[model samples]
Target: MNNFVKTTVLGGLIFLTPIVLVVAIVGKGFSLVHGLAKPALQVLSVETVLGAATIHIVSVVLLVLLCFLAGLYSRTAGAGRLGNWLEKRLLEKIPTYPLLKAKLRSALQPEQLETLQPIMVRFDDSWQFALLVEQVKPDASLVFLPGAPDAWSGSVCIVSGDRVEPLDVSVQRIIQLMKRLGEGAAPDLSQLRFGAHEA
Candidate 1:
């Protein structure tokens, strides 16, 4: 009974942490942008035209414009060098920053998602679905074992290539399966081996 409660609570945390972090980050950014734009709105007396709602509308517009400008700037060669410098010198120092960056990139960039190959990893008597992150060596593969309920909280492992079977499935499909807590995965689950490992 205690183990079940602990497991359930942990699963809930895993599912909520990403959502909470995203909401908190966006809220903080909006607050900062709104604070900066508030004085300007008051100076221009825009409140007289739109009344109380003007501040929010103006803040949102400014935030969107700022995001557009930043995206444009990041496309330049200098931005690439600056980004690398910041990551190596400052951003990488923060423990969660790298993981956050990778997750964000994977979410926003389709090409990054394409690179993550779906596969089945032999784990004792059962098979676990994972993403083939990279080929660490000729016989060793780096894989991401996604956690159920929240795929982002997965763990990375370097396993033997022989134990990893590449699947004819998409990364998005695998993520959806994880998000659904492996429901409707009977066809895939049927492939799990018993007793002995396969070559």
Candidate 2:
């Protein structure tokens, strides 16, 4: 009974920690942006013209525009260096920032998401779902075997190239399927090329 209780509590904590952290970060960011937009709202007298509700919408628009501008700037060579320097000197000092940034990047960036390819890795008679990291040699490939229900946590394995079968699915789709505990994997796995190889 004691072991069960302890295990359950730890599981709950692991599940809730990411959610709580994301919520806290989002709330803080919105508050900061809203504060910055307040002075502009006062100068424009938007409250007098459109009422209080529109001010919140305007703040959200400003926040989105700010993000767009930052994205553009970050793409530039000079801005990229500056951003890296700021991350190294300031942002990295905050423990959660690096993890949060990586998660956000993988979620938002198409190029980054493309690097983690969904695949099936052979293990004796059975094949396992995995993400292909890269080919270390002509015949050996490095892959990540993600834990079910928690796609981010996983182990890396080096297996023969022939043992890896690329799946025709998006990284996000695979992650969602994993989070659903393999409930809706049939449609995705239906396209497997194993039969062709066997013949």
Candidate 3:
């Protein structure tokens, strides 16, 4: 009876999670549209327009215009700094900023940053293999290997250059392979090796 109850609960959650997420997304989108439309319609007096169609058209046009102007302003010298400052301040206030920043920093770091040393390891001694980025000296580096669905929530490992074998592979190719076969797979680097020098 206890096992039956647990199985039922697990199955219910598996079915309900996607439905819950979709409903949440729809609610958020509706709220955003309402926020944008309410103030614009109040100021413009939608009653003056021919009908509902006219009101919707005007609202959409206004929204597009506002977005375009905002984009243009952000690109300007003075506005660019202000926009960046505002974004940074907003991100700092969020509770999840540190977690998000750490994940993003790991994924987006330049290839040059990984130049210390590379190692090839049977990651976790499982079928999955990965090219580990090596850290130098007192300053250690953390590589967050992304998992399925949420890339941010992955295994974090402290690794150094001497332990990892560097693969002569482009970042794009690695990303493509990851997307196809996931973190369990490694790209075939043997084909990419240069010819041996004759004695």
Candidate 4:
């Protein structure tokens, strides 16, 4: 397919996915409130005392209160630890939980979290964009060279810090550029005057 079409679809999916996810979550929450409040609404004969609106209003109020209480409880000392324990024991075993949690976290974090540093790597005759995982010493860094299209598979190398010219770009942008296979995504490296291995 053409790049324009591919980019348009990709952009649409990115915009719509979170919206769909939020709507789904709210829909389920609404259903839960309806089922849970039906008996209470009927028992008190609230529909007659107030009106048909009473049932729906009561259900929504109860749902909000229930959510507030749950959030309040999760922050307390004992409940916090208990929740963590339960998550590790039960939620962690669910195959997609960790991946979903990580994606959610990355989305929620600030735009520049600075967990990784993008670097233009030059070693001998090879040059590529890579992430500086860590710098154990002043002149050495653990770098990861991510594969194009799917960056999850990559090789790690211990490269001299001198040969890795750090880029003043966000790691997320670096990943996106690599995923696009350098299609108008390469970072500016003209300012890199030193620490290049003449690639």
Q: Which pairs clash (backbone N, Cα, C closer than 3 Å) in model 4?
A: none
lDDT for residue 11 in candidate 1, whole number 0-100? 71
User: Residues 1-199, candidate 2, lDDT per residue (tens digit)?
Assistant: 9999998797677666667888887678778888888888788766555577776887788777887998898889999899899999998886556545656776787578788889999787677889998889999999988766767656788998878888999888877887898888898888786545452
Give the candidates in order of lDDT, highest first. Answer: 1, 2, 4, 3
For model 4, what is the alpha-carbon lDDT of residue 25?
Answer: 76
Show model 4 residue runs off by greater than 4 Å. Answer: 1-30, 44-69, 120-133, 136-163, 175-182, 187-195
What is the lDDT of every predicted structure here? Answer: 0.81, 0.79, 0.53, 0.73
* RMSD values, in order shown: 3.0, 4.4, 8.2, 6.3
lDDT of 1: 0.81
Off by over 4 Å in 3: 1-51, 76-89, 92-142, 155-157, 168-199
Ranking 1 against 2 by lDDT, winner: 1
Best-first order by TM-score: 1, 2, 4, 3
lDDT of 3 by residue, 119-191 (tens): 2333333322243444445544454464433333346576553334455655444444555655433345553
What TM-score goes with each of the models? 0.80, 0.69, 0.46, 0.54
Residue 6, model 4: Cα distance from true site in angstroms: 20
- For residues 1-199, write the lDDT of model 4, one tens digit per residue: 6999998797566545555766787779878898878887688765556667776787788778987998899779999899899998997885445544545655766453477788888867667888888998888999888666645345789988778887887878766776788677533656666433554
| Residue 198, model 3, lDDT | 14
lDDT pick, better of 1 and 3: 1
